[model samples]
Target chain A: MERLLAVRCPGLIEEDESGGVLRAFDRVVAAVEASCPWVTVVRTGICTLPIRGPARYFGGEHAVVDLVTAAAVEAVEAAAEAVEGGSSVEAVEVGIAEGTFAAVLAARTGTIVEPGGTTAFLAPFPLAVLGERDLADVLARLGITTLGAFAALPERHVLGRFGATGVACHAVATGRSGNLPGLADPGAGRRLHALRHPPPPPDRQPGFWGGASEADARAAQVLTRVQGLLGPDGVLTARLQGGRSPAERARDVPWSARSRAGRSGGTGSQPPWPGAIPPPAPLLVHRDRPAAELVGLDGTAVAVSGRGVLSGEPARLSVAGGPWERIAAWAGPWPTEERWWTRGHRRTARLQVVTAGTARLLVVERGSWQVEATYG
Target chain B: MFDSVAPGRVPGRVPGRTAAPASTTPGGRRDPSALAALDDLARRIRPTAASGTRLLPVHPALAPLLPEPGLRRGSAITVTAAPGLEGTLAVAMALVATASTGGSWCAVVGIADLGAVAVDGIGVDLERLAIVPRPGPHWAEAVAELVDGVDVVVVHPPFAPRPAAARRLVARARERQSVLVIVPGRAGWPEPPDVRLTVESSHWEGIERGAGHLRRRRLLVTGGGRRAAGRMRRCELWLPGEDAGPGVAGVAGVAGVAGVAGVAGVAGTSGASEPA
Candidate 1:
């Protein structure tokens, strides 16, 4: 089916002052995806390329156009709202026609031309819609205000007066033009699947929130729900009871406490906590891959065991640059003290040294002096 | 040199009327007749290119210590601190704040010891900041890459490196016009740098009252290099806010330094320091 799509940034001019136009566009795309599963939203500069394959697969021209129109409008509206300080002013202008050029002209001129009426729809538009203002103005000077007027002139006369641009405008106005095909069909049955599952039990709902007393059970239930939602994705978002969410709670808790609790409260004595989730290790992921350590520039890596035990010897260290000389002066085991009773146990040994030219602080466990953190 | 002539005896009006110069130039130009007058005026208004570039003014105490009195677009400077996390972080943060004010891109490479809040407290624009955690043994290479991409790259090297690698990185920094600030983790460098500022704790006070005070020892600057044999200068500085009047003072001590006194007019001693 042929579809008409209109994408616009009503507050585009004011975007600098209020921001969020791009974010709104994202939401608009999301909403469109949610509503019209078969319509693909193309994001070229000023125009959208709607492929006809999916439209044809679904049915015919009218159905595709309707889907495209609905999706486009919904997306634009949602995007406008998503923008910070966004309002209804950022409305989209949609126009549909048989040809890509015709459709683009119709959209720019705010006209929706009926199918097979591309020539008539484009006829009234000024040649400026063709994106050649100079030629359009020249034609208008000769009393050719609209495309139809310009096209009515002799072909030789247009060519003689305005060159290729004039001739192109004439051809499009007369309904004899060539451009790229419309968007292909966005495959039928290729919609994003949001699986519907049974709601949580009444006791697990926010209405039944029981502070601390039911915190563990509720947390477990939330995790189970998240796992179900994530499926094999391995990533999950869980909504917990109370004012704060589960993710917020996890971040607020200390890493040391979570790590030392040992999945079974440590001390080799207790059963694993029902819903405790361990924190991710402090792993630094770089966008670019790194080479193995070079002699002078490489830094030592020390490993610390749980319960503040030091393992292995202090290895060679890496250097980037700075005052390596001064840092070397005091390079040794430096103790760090932390209150173990606190929520997050943060006792560590900081070895200060300079390698290469940079000064760094390599943190080891206070008791063991094994590596924990590095300041580069 | 015209001073207010007290009740002059020269021309128009009363006995107290002061004579106005008949010449067009307020202070007569140096014709043979005007030579003495011009010489006297020259003594009154001597200009010296304002001493430093107004575009980028380094702290007075730091001016003499740096290769130039001000940091330019394409220059590398390093700050060193005593062994510990606190001092190194303080220096790194100060540099970040300084670079940010100049609208340059600043990145912390291989340094994850600081909390975001602490860095922010030192006035570093966190929004424009990019922090990279310790990238293991290949830190120098990572730092070189970062330096190429950013205006300033602050790296805290663990300990000594082979002399060859250190020289290579230094060449890279000079080629790219990127500032490489190395926070020394160990002691002794294979080569001396263009400029080096060593930081040591003189004293710290006000911890109990929640108002933290850091008193740093004198900044010892050594110029040239081992081969060239550089000059050494030491200076003391304190951070204090400028008052409504003209004079500058040390926050907790008397402003003794002579060279730094004149340029201490900037408000807020947050980043103030005297150049040696």
Candidate 2:
């Protein structure tokens, strides 16, 4: 009679720094929502959803999990699309059991609990997670560590000391509270009617316009107003993105395909990403197609010697044809030897130098000196 | 066609942005204001972005080395060294580190010599990594599985695969929105890749012939192919570079998309010192 599915992400929510990534949590919500209507999300990325209805619809528990997994993948993909290069959801553990708590712990282990295995599955959990930290400490002091041990304690004694909270804990600890939380999706039963259908033209408000040209003028006026509300620069125009190779990476999704995907509400059915973190990269990665030559104080190239030794101390380099500045501080002459045993072998070195102007540059030396990179 | 050198040869690959009165170069590095505006656009979309990124985060050093911005999903690039490995794996790991640390899964499909310990030491979370050491005859199929399940798949084909099979794998990668990194080996790929990156050479600093230990390395990465075409981007970046040790691996990289005839090692930020 109990079919609760618990999905848990170990440190997801608690690890959020600015709470911006919290929006990504919707990836999980939308994923499960695809399979069932009754979902209750708890803190710590733990979600409990009743699967009885979905199981019936999908034919069995295995089939339901498969469908849920697929939906979860789609949700993750959507999150990736939204943030582009963000910290995305790549994996999740789902647990199915008779009740919420059991399913939660089961999810922690990343395995499924059979229909009748709830008791055996839960008996191994440490009493520390049994709720009521103070009581759990007391129980621990009394030599009870595992739920199996605490479950052996007399019910009357537990009731006498712990009272209502104790009884509830005992019920969960003994796997008797599997049916505690109510099972109904509050949002599932209520259908959203807005995007479902557009309002008919007959229901449109009539304007006091004289002719078609006047209506067109009014529409232009309205567009200006909307632009004002949304801001002149807020509307993002599609542009080609760049990368090292794929020409596609530089192109936007064709407008027609994008419209078709949007019309399908491919995203409408999904929820937003919550607490989803984006990847941490720098402001810009400048290329090395153009470089400056760094020379030592002696007016000679700051070269890595044939013996992989520096010819002299680094002194200066012209910046993009700008004036040459003195090197303030420097480090390196790291030698690199690749394919040494073959014909294409190369032996070279590099150095990190800070200029008197306080600019940083990575200089490379093969037969000549070149500024490899600058520190922002 | 997938050569990471001489990208200008490819057809249908146009300049990144239209030429403005000031946009002389394809990437327009000469236009400082344009670069500043691009940074502003990044801030507009995600203001508090870790590094003001409009694209995915790559090592600060390797950013400008990319053809456009940073790496994107659904893009496949081949990483090769003229005749050796030379920082190829190190750079690949750095790129993947951006996504992997953020909870995404990464899989290494065909490289058998790789061990989980060394990879874990390079900052890849072993828990999220799937290793397929020996795919044998089903190398392509194995990569397909990883592409389906993980976000980044680093594959070095054990043997030459048919062009049709390679194309199918590439299509799968696009459909699934996963990144496929093809590292060239003895057998080589039957067809060209969308993007090709080659480590033309590497310069190691902090070592004296055979005495001192190498503290850092500068990898000369050349990127070209259909996407880059005539506007090939070249850079000298670090790969775990000696000083990058495990702790600094995520923060390591230096991309100087240098041009030919002293025009190499262009402008940019230091990567080895910052996290992407």
Candidate 3:
């Protein structure tokens, strides 16, 4: 999760008929930009900036908070002076937390929640803070009032009961995901651009080689229809992140959200993991790992020792207790140890075993074997 | 650069432009310069290299197994493996990799456990690829919708489809000019496709008795279909062949290439009417 700082102006939030409030908000943005170069406009009067780098440069989070608050207050005062009969500017609110959604709520009360404490801090807040009226009303009727109570529901159950948007809200409530689709206004930046520059006369001819290609537009149309048919989570796109195993390395992100962010797709630079298996990666990574057994020539169950060494050479393999096939060739016991100090620590070893015409990746942990993936 | 000057804003247009003399001499000789300029204009206004009626490009290695030029648009191709072989999914991914990377949109439906790394390794641009892991009962509807817009639609029906449903999808693909690549795993496709690619036999190399890593595998792919693609062609490929460039049959890992020498080189033969 990204640590972000949010700035909210209560006075200039609602726009007046004269556009004076927006101009005042723009002044506030300019003032904040002087201190942090990456200030992003979340909406008309709301903005956010990342705090990690600035916090380091300014000595600590506390010092950066103070600096940002001072800058925002000065800007509001200047804007208040410029507009005579406009909405009177009030004290600027600034706070820092992990993710823009939580940071915005933190800014409302000028509270800087500690890092890794976002879930606990957000626990007692009412469902209204989630900004979903119908969902909050329904959840309230079921006696789930607080965000923490709603977060306690199993993720699959939440997804089944409330659909994709509900699952997104549930993820935010649980601190598992930082982004909620409706939290950031997609057109806020374009709105600001329109304000900064008066429009030129509309051109008659279309620009050469501009906009999305015809194929992209058509694909977007059909994908949107698919989303409508099977809900937002049904249509997904894969994003590759750095991890040890194939499952951990790639995850399915909702296609609608991915497209809205306007990110040019491709795997970005990922940190090299030391123990990850080399890449002529398996074509099929089994989601439900079927149980398998690997036995030696003597029919004794083969296992991996504490030193990551195999007890015996595997000679036969059976998946889900199906008919056993001769293991013509095999390799590995790539051991991985995760979170050793925690109670949830796990140690497993993986092997590549081939049968007549099929090859599979097998993992053994605590003297049991399961098929992890298949080379096919 | 010339386009930067908007047409409406350009000055000095002759009022009698439509009434101008033809670019030909009195003796009916053509003006070479004017003809060249017209040809340049036509070329500039043509559709992009990847679009229009042009065939979708295939990977250099797999090109020999398909029709003369490349994969035909509005055609259906079924990729199936022999009863015990497991390289059908690998073969299917190889078939679509080139078209997907050429800026065409491809979607995979009903493939729940798709390995993204392997797909990326096969060179399919992830940006243009969409996946509907489980469409459930809306399988046909979802596939039909995608076929309308996507350049390629690959589906594995969770259940056996009614013959009518299969035929309708084939018709839709033809109408939309999209390629349909079906992997029909357990629930088989009822209608025959234009090109049917079967993985005859496959064997892993470079590993024995737990000594070395799983380097690569050699697959025997035989292409057979109806009409234009009826001729049977056999191709021996080293999928994810040594060196990480996926699905290049005879390229890279020269030592491993000779491992399948006895698989009968039938690529150039009049390969037709071989028993299925």
Candidate 4:
């Protein structure tokens, strides 16, 4: 099961028509994202982030929990002050466990379940914790009120009675899968995306009369026409941001009337990252990562060590199983130890490899190499 | 006639715009540098109204490779490379970088994965650049529409554009007075362009087995086409010079530096000559 740490904002759990709760939740998520990247939003107030990477970075899971709990408290307090005009702040709850389902339950009671102990930790909880009111009522009527009792039922017998949802819940109860199909709000991501990239502000007006120059007005008209032919997301304007790789440093946002202002701003305030690839960024950053293979002089596969050293001196390379070409010259193994906890963690490092005619950025994750970008 | 209206304006606004007090003296004492300075002054002092029909500025290093002083408006320039050659896209980006920075709105079509940072590093203004990554089958229509308003439209057609469609698009660019740059990578262009620039080969320097990073690339660019651009021209260039901007290999001084450490790359030799 995927180990996850979940944050449950009890005050913001229920949807509010005013959108104040979601806004507050956004602050909490942002606060958490500052210390950790890739904070996944499971719902409006509830969120989960993978623990392996951060756990290792912050020393251990206990340290990460302490850090996140403090950050969430401060963010929630500030948000509550803004939303409710200085009402008493509610206590934010956080927990860590193997699966998101168990982790969220653990968050409600503010406890951390030890690894390999999720099923034991969840045994005493009532069926109501599953959030299935119908199943809880039926199970209560049958005198099987606790999760332990329901989990004790035969898998086939429960499926015969309760159908697919029952089978999924049973799997969660047995601690087999971290996923529950309907547990996460599918619309949360879209709603957050809308919040992050709102429509162009009214001040940045387009066309000839008021602010924009004549050329901008003409370009806006034709770009809008192209948008009509190819949807709104078709035409995009590029913006530079701070990141470790070429793809991360730059992003293409859909072109709009506001883009005519052409403010290609940089992340001036971003903290410097140590392992970022040196300048002269690649000409192309592949959208679909292509598989690659790097072999040493004797034809053995090359890899990166735990200490960021190359396992072999690469001499030949092939991409997507193509014919091998000699590695004429190469640069450093710019190692990025993002997540190196266990076997499946994304412990990857990048290298700039030049063949007879081309230069490419190759990343090796899980002992397999992939072409990340090309200096075309 | 309007040259004196902004007599000081031209030199003040443009860097490297020398007053050329020595050239003010008459008596057929003109030199090549003086004539080049006069030509530059003429271009800078030209009224904005005439800019609609005038050539768009290109990086000075690439000026010799083109038939005109700069990229001519209302024309098509196709960039191509041999099957396995690299740097075609880099050359195309370098071609439009100057005009884009000079306030020309440019659009890219059907070329996803364009490294905008590198484009910016090559001196292209990202703000004036719009990219239509995947126009699907409507790429021709998208390019046609963009060509109407955009000053330069760079398109890499996902498939071979029909000759008639390509001709019509070329004609549209001519009518609209927009420069069209085609990078027909794999999906070849059927219609003949006004000027076709091909990258014969590309070589990278500043990196050897496990040492320095990739610092620069040298490209061999050849230009040829019909009509005024009939004569073939070739130029050696660093598409990404030492500082990551394009520069003429011959004049950049760093050109003499061989691909070796210590001996070829002595301190202050190359850096002192590069343009600030």
lDDT of 2: 0.50
Which candidate has the top score in DockQ?
A: 4
* Candidate 3 ranges beyond 4 A from true positions: A1-211, A257-272, B1-52, B250-276
True contacts kept of each: 0.00, 0.03, 0.44, 0.49
Pairs in steric clash, model 3: none
- Model 4 residue A288 lDDT? 94
Number of the predicted model whose lDDT against the real structure is largest: 4
- By summed lDDT, the worst window of 10 consecutive residues in model 4 chain B runs over B267-276
- In the range A1-376, model 3's lDDT, one tens digit per residue, is 6778988776665444455666787888878877764566775567888798788889998898888888887888888866545334645778787877788767765779999999997788877666566677789899998889999989898888899979999998898775665555433443443454332234522222645665677788889989998998899898766678878767888887336311233333234567877666777789999999999999999999989999999999999999999999998889998667899999999998999989888999899999988987
Q: For candidate 4, write residues A126-202 as lDDT tens digits.
A: 77556565777788899997777888899999899899989888888888865665566534543453354333344
Better of 3 and 4 by lDDT: 4
* lDDT comparing candidate 4 with the true structure: 0.73
Q: Listing every candidate in turn, what is its Cα RMSD in Å to the true structure after a full C-alpha superposition? A: 25.5, 27.7, 22.2, 27.6
**Candidate 4 residue B31 C-alpha distance from true site, Å:** 46
Candidate 2 residue A44 C-alpha distance from true site, Å? 40
lDDT of each residue in B1-276, candidate 4, tens digit only: 011112121121111101132222222123577657645543442223254445998887677778897888778999998668788788887788788867689988987888776777777777788899999788887887787688899999987787756865886676456899999957689889999998887888778999898887777788889899998887777767765467776422344444422221111111111110
Candidate 2 lDDT by residue in tens digits, B54-112: 23445445565566666666678787777633456666666666555454566666554
Query: Could you tell me the lDDT of residue B273 within candidate 1?
Result: 22
TM-score of chain B of 4: 0.73
Task: Write the number of the candidate with greater lDDT, choosing between 1 and 4.
Answer: 4
